[model samples]
Target chain A: MNPYHILNKLLCEEEELTSEERKAFVEGLKSDPELVRVFTGWLQVHSHLMERLPETKDLILYSLAADGHADDLTHQEASYISDHWKDIDSVVESHPGFKDLTHQIAQDRQDFLDCWGSETASVPQVFRLPAWSYQIAAVIAVLAVAAFATIFLVNYQDRSMQLAIATPGEYQRILLPDSSIAHLSGPATLEYNSERFGRSVQLTGQAFFEISHRPKQFIVRTNEAMVQVLGTRFGMRSGNDMTQVILESGRVQVASNETPPRSIVLAPGQMTDVVKGEAPTPSIDVNIEDELRWTGFVFLRNTPMRKAAVLLSSSRNVNIDVDPLLMRESVTGTFSPDIPIQEVLDALTLTLNAQVIEDEDGFRIVPLFP
Target chain B: MAASKFDPQLVLRAKKGDERSRNVLLERLSVVLERFFKRKIGDQALVDDLIQCTLLRVHSGLIALKHPDKFKAFAMKAALFELHDYYRGRHSMKERSFEPELLPEKNYSINQSSGDSMDVEKALELLKPRTRRILELREHGYKYREIADILNISETAVKMQVKRAFEKMKTIFAD
Candidate 1:
């Protein structure tokens, strides 16, 4: 029998197993190692699913218990909790490991009540009218009218304060009225308004901008540095000392083009870095996509380790820890953020001999290559 | 039954200082809770701790519930109160015998307790107090929205707490 069939049989738990059928199923599993692996994997997945949900069986038991007052599950009358507890005496009585902990959790209910009960006061009645006051209903009518009028006159008035969030590895395409395309990366945020307002955007974290080739100047501001491009296809990265600009197309000069800003002419495949308070460096050949991975692409032609890892972390919406010494280690390879974090970590480990440790949020990388 | 009968919109509205809404909402959720618990507990003495409290908590903290779509999960969280409370009562008495027919026998081996017990315990300990409480609620199969109401926190927070708790657990287990 195939693994899927075996898994289905296991799940359904039907069809009495004859001696011949049992032998055949085991024989089939043994004969094909690949099938056995799949079968075991399915079994493991089921086990996890079961563990993921603890009280389902108890819920079923509750449903079958056929008690009348217990039927009102909405009210915690102590009837249901008593019967459906996952760890009963039978399960924990002999197991010394679970006995103390189970009892501790059980006994702690009083403690929770002591803390929580004090704060749970009755809801106070809001402003009220006379018991039969006609004005009470009339007031509601007036408020409704005012709310509708305000909504009709000015739509929501909330674009300024609302923060947009994107899930990991998901891309949000924001289109400005001026025909500018912004591919916003997950785990990064940028706030902006229409061109009529200021034609400026406040970018706190990392993002890519293919600014519309417009008459007015387009500016992107970060804490470390600012990049002003007019109708250009380029990526500017700024944060701390790691300010960089990778020009892909169009002709645009950076602001206050001083030696410190590192004004450098670049062709198709060059990237420049302007360290905070330092001059911008000369053009060096690099992968535009890798440098701009937060915006779109993953592989860098030649990228710093920390930058690459940050891109992967942004893609996964995970915080990663990296030792300071490993930030400068150069890498020339490709990584797909859409791929599993494990696979990406494996690539870094096997290729660079780095050690990755798990944290509550994500992973930390320590350099072992040296 | 019609889904709207327990539709979360009415319940939340009542929780936020509306009396009529509260009565209507409570009445609706009561149906599901009653059916679920009546079958599970088989004891009237415990119903109040199991079902009544979840409803009351949901009623009192309805302001915290944002998503009506997650009502089922919230109800499940509310159910956890009874389970945890029941365990607590049992702990006080050191009573071991329960509705024993449901337990899986082989998992009761002596050696099994020492290894898995400490790992689960520490992970439970590391959780934020609210998360620890919520996990206990969730483990007992309380509805997600009910948990939100009882904790007076957002559903999103509950989700993040669970995810963080599990991640911490995975690390501890691995270690």
Candidate 2:
């Protein structure tokens, strides 16, 4: 078969090229630099066509609404929107018809509100996300930096201290050189020293532990506090200048590392927060289940897509762009953070009747039909 | 990694039996949920029923949600369950596919691009109408066989037309 035939198939269709064809294309691109240039050109043209293709827009809104199958072109558009919502105003502004469509949507949105009995009475028309949104985003960035710092700080230790790190939007499960299991949420790191049979773990960010009981007390050292336990279930969140330890089903002694240090014993269902330069405080009455919600699967009952995107973006470490216009739209469903980002995007796209465009960089969510 | 900014205050309020906050949260998600169901079922009447059912399920289960931070994922999970149930019901109807009872308005328009780098649009405009339709269908992720079925043409014919369209695009770009 002609190689261009295979290349054309890959370029034109939304479905992935067959593995055999993809491999052939890869080999061809490698051997034929001209083919690479042509492929790049085709990609550029394809992107432009994707933008201008009216069918792509129709399919994005109707394909799933009309049929359950999400079209690939629409998927690309959705991913683009998710990644580029901030830049979309320029795109929309340039499109002469989009202004009219936005108006129509705003008007129809009112009709949609009437059908739903004016939930608007409860939800304000506009929610100006406070300027601190960036500050909040910075916390995740700091936690990510801290994760790396923890690894570098432990560099002098036995080379056997295995590091398990989760970036934002990711989770890492480590079988400590001991039999204990550590579930690390992203922007978090867990360094296990196996030499002593997982006797010590340095944790930064949020992690859930179901430690195995051993004769020796397992020591967990964090920036603000040290948690010592024999064996039990607990979760610790240490970052952005505060350390919180929640004992879910075990007893733990948390000691602040501050000068004139203070310590507290926490029973199951107790929680404590320790800040820099302060001693660990007394355990507070709390719901253990709530403290450890991140350890389990996530189910959104009636979550604004804006909030969902924020939660999913931070957890998954993928940038999800929600159109400011569609920020108020809510999504209701059960989803596990453990699922592939594409699946989550697919569900969100299908659920919101939105379009998701995924380029090589990341995912974008476009909530409006236009 | 830990999520930096969860709506802890809003969540705390909802958890404390603040029905108003709960309503606010639900109302916030309503548009997204509506779009979700409308996308899958494409039936105006059924979308309302499914939304209510999903909301009722959320209401019953909301008290048990310990962390409001996970509400989005939790709600999405419920909507997904409802979606599965919808498919299951549609399947029991014995139709080959879940045909939409109503089609949404296709009012979104595409403007022709006019710029130095927008030659692709100009090239696209040059294709024959039937050829353009076939390419557009393919662009929308339809298989050649499906496009053939939709256009009342043979699968081989669809492939030939698509190939020809690619050749035309290449020629236009090469110029």
Candidate 3:
């Protein structure tokens, strides 16, 4: 007999498997690493399915029982219920939430019935209007709603805001009305009212913000803390009842969202964290490039090509060799880390009329002609 | 019984671009999928997402289904795919630096507690649909002979599928 058959019989606890076969299967699992791995995998999948997949018959019967319609069960259903009453009862006893599940099922069934209107109902011919009239009425109603919604949305848009969400595996770059830039990491949401514009935004997860200088302070708020900046670049991450703000090139004031909030000002290359219901921690020095790596935005402001290349190579885990003469040349640009390193290098070299060459070890940036 | 209740004629009509039939089919499927998901996962929001994703999968894949009679299996397969994707996402979330505070409390708890193993679900995707069906049925407490009867194949064929599924899983685990 196949080992899987024996395994299946053992899992099912069937008496059909010979004792010798069962012993052999157990012994193989104990002795062979490969067999043990496969068996473990099989068992995991089996348990997961058992836990996730409902026993249709039991579920149907349970729903009926929970709904107080046990009397309506068919003869076969009643027989199965009687035979498996202990198992069914144990399951129901364990999952107290099954009642809510039945209620949800009833609601779902009602929704289905509502969507699938009475197909069996017959309308009197005298009361039936021409199909074209119904269509025309629907079109008119739709137009009226559309017109109203358009006006409402126009007003609502001014008052409420726009929401930008970056799901897992996505990096989104958004430009605020004031020409400020917000680079959102995956699994993050940034919401800001258009009317409020670049002044303030609510953030969840993590984001790097480049704020434009303005009279009104630019603020980023999270559940735990708030960050206020003026014409500065910084990365803010909020989670686990704590918010951390790291200032890169400018100053930022971090404060707890709690009442009587204690605040701390973070200078360039410094970071602070605000725990829930507490004051912001004192600013501590940090490596700005390392801290903001998640945003994948490399901000270079008149930095020499040598330093830029080192930063790029470290951030992207690639070796970049710049030509000797070009090392002293300065590069000024904000590069999105998501773009391929090669593409970014190409674009960067393009500005200097230089070329990028690829080799097995990594990439080398040399003068276009030399 | 759920499979028996699914009308292949409606699926055929939906495949032929019958809007009314498609709407009705999807509505019924939504109820089934909701129940299927709710039983497994307690998060209503995740259940709702799974239902919508599965429905979309079924809708898009409906055109490619050659045998309308296999609609239940097809729909179930779609649901399985969505569920698998959900588990896979949860697994990857563990490997990555996901902000747990961003997830709703209940969903966070569920995600943290489940899919902690080496994830055999990915390996299951390598099996043929028929073989997968047999393995799933067997896992659900159906005997090999019963699964063979349900799929209208011989008992030996069902055993073969089980063996093949395990062999495939073994290779995946080995790697």
Candidate 4:
């Protein structure tokens, strides 16, 4: 008797089995310990599944269009939905019936609000006017508000005062007041003020910038160095003691804030590092894309073990203690920020001929024993 | 359920102040939380907020976690606490129709918690979509007959899919 067959019949089938078939099922489970173990495991899995909820995106959409009170949504949810609105839009757009339904619903914001909003008292007053008349009135009201806001901004507000910050373990992409885009890995901050008309940004930590081309000098100031560009794409990292800049495209000038301050101009595919009170390193050719992996994952190519450790620690924001002797060993491979940290350690151990001890204090990388 | 090879090292690194490891751990567990919350809250928009709250607690409380191998259990406890806190904050307003019978067993043992499901989840990713769906339905307590009806397939097909999914899962968990 096939135990798997009998077990499946017992577990999955709804109909009652014959006396002989039931006998076979019980006999299979009673005789084979492996079958019993598998069956027990399946029961545990079933119990666990019973505790979980199904993924129901379609049902959620149905509820959203029918119920407008999204008080349940936090700020993150709103931003996520707004950012991925195209995905939701695409779904409705692909279907002609949904397209028509959305078009009808969109034209009447009040109708959507009435359906989805938690409040019901306003529905009667909102319905007092005809739909077309209400829409025209709403349009005028919106334009009037927009015109007032525009005048207020032109007359009183500072256009460039804004701050973009990326928190630890996160990435942020912000559009500068000047229309340039800044991508920052966490523990980074970018500050712009109207004093520079948004042309100058003070940066700490690490960031990638795509400056818009303009006659105005777009300057990025770091603790150790300053980057000046008309319009370009670049990546910059400022540590406690040194500042590094890599220009991906266009031209930029890097000025070190040393005692004997020196300025160097850089073209595409060039990188320079500046140390406080010391001259900046000569620009070297590096793949800027490869260096930009702090924002994502990067593969190392013939990188020394010491350098790899430093990169891993920096990227993960973790403390890694490596022996001085193993620092000279070289490793050539890729590292992804997605997998578990042990897997990376295992790979390092295999490649670099090293051993890692993970304890309560931290991870220690040492020379492998014979 | 036993801990898989993936999370313990990441948890160890995370506990040691590795922000990247922490982020990866959160990302993977957030998927699990999303599924958990979606079933409980029945509201998609609310799910993200609960997940964020759970993560905040997890992050703040991770330092106190004594065992790296028990990270999943610790995190899930924080998640359940957040759920309790949310309902308490709402003054016990019933957001949706929920029966106690449908709830997770109150006597659920942390030792027997669904740590193994993470491995099963990974294995399910490798299965055919139909087979995975069949197993998922089964996990949700759907009988083979019901799954067959829902999928418009034969009962034999449902049984075959369940067996195949279990076989694949067994192989994955073995490693």
Candidate 5:
């Protein structure tokens, strides 16, 4: 029942104290000065270990085995505690309180283990986290990942999809809220409410669409052409010289105000290069993913240095100059848009002995060896 | 309400992509952030600006905020981003100026006070695992009685370990 015995049990593996006995000691501490000081000191050590021992648990256990679990008790530790157990033994000969605390701590641990065992052994099945926590964790993780990926896929899809006829302004590819795809071309701007699943767009400069297969109709309309489809791949062009429709796959009946808008069976590999007030002429050899390569891949392996440099310039929307002397070297690497310019330079420097120097305008590649 | 119980429940809801749950977490955490950032950013003006920007990002990006339980670290990172942006934007507008040499190696006044707390943590590390457990329960806002109950040790045992831990801290700090 003595506080010291409880304290000792806590320090040693004496055993867990009963809940009622521990509670009484807590009440006793309010009136005891020595108890207050001792408790505070224990707190200091406890927190210190908790914060640091996360990665050092095994090491501490190893030390425990070596040192017999008794931390080296220096003169200070002795003074801090009984200050020479033998001498204090006579002074505190009547202090039966000390051993009991240590004993209770051990007893309590045993009690806890007993409780843990009963709960565990009674069940034949493996323990699992609470249902709500497991369900919530799974749902939250999936949704959060989906939201992130949606943002990513939508951005990537936007880059690869373009609006046929854009105005003479900054072109932006829009992932229609419905997952239907469209690339904003020319100077025209296309905006989609990604929060909503409606595949509606207003067009200026022409764009193309690989509309996602869905029950809803995907619609794109410009001043010249209004095109509708169930689910198809097609390209439309609106410029000074012409308004054209190129169908890569699926079917689209192209109609326009200026031209007698007629039905076009645009099969695979068909390019409808249309001029306003003229017949729709289908063409060939369309590099769809390649055409949008600027928004897709800035770094290409085994690509000509000059061409890669040009691609990097447009892709990053930064002006970069390559030393003409290194033009003949074939460049090979993969680069993400998020890569820092320094990292890019480091890769080049390591691979080709190429070094990059910087100025206010941009970066210039210079070879260290050549 | 119990701090331990409240934190995990809020964290669970927030992690489950509940925007409201995240808002509650941020609200609970705003107090912690105020304390955390006040310690880091000396200037009151910049601190306020950074806090505002961080909260704005948290609100707009709640659904996008992946780790809801690690709200404290997440918010701190947000503040860091805001600070980076502010300095970058300011650099663009201002003329070139000489910057002061901030030698962190030189121990300052604030370091002295915190240095003790650090010593305390270090000293606690020297104790055996059981002693360490008893000490941690006491520090994490647990009552000696509660710690005894939780760790199944006697209150006196908890007290002894605490005293022993303090002595260790004093020594560690002395070193």
Candidate 6:
């Protein structure tokens, strides 16, 4: 047999050669540099291609596995599987890459099917849209009616359209239709028109808004004020006849809800307050990370030990004390709220080179030597 | 974040210019691409860059895709293209010198560590466009018979093209 023929058979894994042919092929490779070069080049391409492209048969197997061997298989796919069942079984058993690919593809298929539901196959009929079309048309009609009903209900409910709420002691993350995120600290409610979601929202209590950018303004209304932004992130708290707005990044306009609606523009790291009947207070530069710490992210920007203790105490509801000598020492780092308070304390004390003494009441920071 | 599944409906919606759906699809594709690249290349930073590039390619080419159900195949091809680009770029940057003395060493085993210097992309460029396509289809896990069916050629012809392409690569690289 020609050496090139043997090389092709070996690379394609078409068939096992007889022992004599294998010996001749090995001897040719050992003696012939030109043949070896051809073999090497072909082998490299084959291996890389195998790594990059999934086999067609494996894709079919994957589809079968993904769809759970249901009646959903196409006639072609069903036939292909039947014809190659033996080869497919052997490959799945022996080829780890194909096995992994099949598993991954099946998992991905299941995830999407769960997310979007299986595609509704249309039943063929003479001179008409498939049966799914009628089903879809009926669904659309019903949805139209339901939409009108929802609009009526919204009007009747006086715009109390509560879309999301976090009760006391609960922290909830709401993904708005516009892809904006609202991290609501408990005792908060976010409401907006279902039909006109992402344009604006009514926020009661404290929440952090990461508004997706758009040309139109996104408005957040509170009892005492309204915050308007094109695209930006900010934190808002409305309660006690007062509303506070703090901009983390981007820009926002805070206005009082009073007649004439006094407004002020706030830059990043600035905050403002609105009294029930007064215009929004002048924007003041503030530590946004510290102010928005309620959103479960601790931002310490050169925060003094004394101030850090106060902030941690209020946020964690634990009394923290710092020795006078260490009070002025500051620490800077961002900590996720998920970190245990003890771990945070250890980190803080480690930075200060101090020791934390835990007592029945709370934690006290003192010099390690002392 | 959980890996997002491939949804043909989402692809259709995105192709129809649904901004929200497009965003969702891109986000989901990112998750899937991240996993795919990470599995292929373990470097986190490189994987991230590959994911971004693949997502961009998918986004730009989505409207041109004729079949929504083939989104996985389309996205995977885009990913493979990007990956190949990376490999080619890395090889060129390294400027690996192929020593003539190493020609005989190639006979040792395809699994030899030095096999990385083969520069498969360069060798692939040596083939004719038709032959290259056949080889590509073969690489994509298509059988020789399937390639013949796809290209409307004979199976023996497909095998002949592949063999000739390998011979051409050997001639070019042996110099």
Tens digits of per-residue lDDT for model 2 on B17-70?
898887866666666677656534444577788888888877777787766765
Model 2 misplaced regions, further than 4 Å? A1-158, A296-370, B1-175
- Per-prediction TM-score, please? 0.28, 0.28, 0.36, 0.29, 0.28, 0.42
True-structure Cα RMSD, model 5 = 28.9
Candidates in descending lDDT order: 6, 3, 4, 2, 1, 5
Predicted structure 2: lDDT: 0.61
Interface Cα RMSD in Å, per prediction? 16.9, 18.8, 20.8, 21.8, 24.9, 18.7
Off by over 4 Å in 1: A1-45, A48-77, A86-161, A164-288, A294-344, A350-370, B1-175
Which residue pairs show backbone clashes in model 4? A67-A116, A68-A116, A69-A116
Q: Which pairs of residues collide in candidate 6?
A: none
Where model 3 places Cα greater than 4 Å from the true spot, the runs are A1-160, A195-198, A299-334, A338-343, A346-354, A358-362, A367-370, B1-175
Q: Which 10 successive residues of model 5 chain A have the least lDDT summed? A: A54-63
Tens digit of per-residue lDDT, candidate 6, span A155-202: 857753557889986887665655466778878998886433547899
Question: 1 or 3: which has the higher TM-score?
Answer: 3
Say which candidate scores most in TM-score.
6
Clashing pairs in 3: A296-A337
lDDT of 5 by residue, A57-170 (tens): 122222222224233222333244442344333322222222222333334223333422322222133456787898898999899999999998888677645434445543
Q: Per-prediction TM-score, chain A only? A: 0.35, 0.39, 0.50, 0.39, 0.34, 0.51
Lowest summed-lDDT stretch of 10 residues in model 4 chain A? A117-126
4 or 6, greater by lDDT: 6
Q: Is the docking of candidate 6 incorrect, acceptable, medium or high quality?
A: incorrect
Candidates' C-alpha lDDT? 0.52, 0.61, 0.67, 0.62, 0.50, 0.68
Error of 1 at B107 (Å): 24
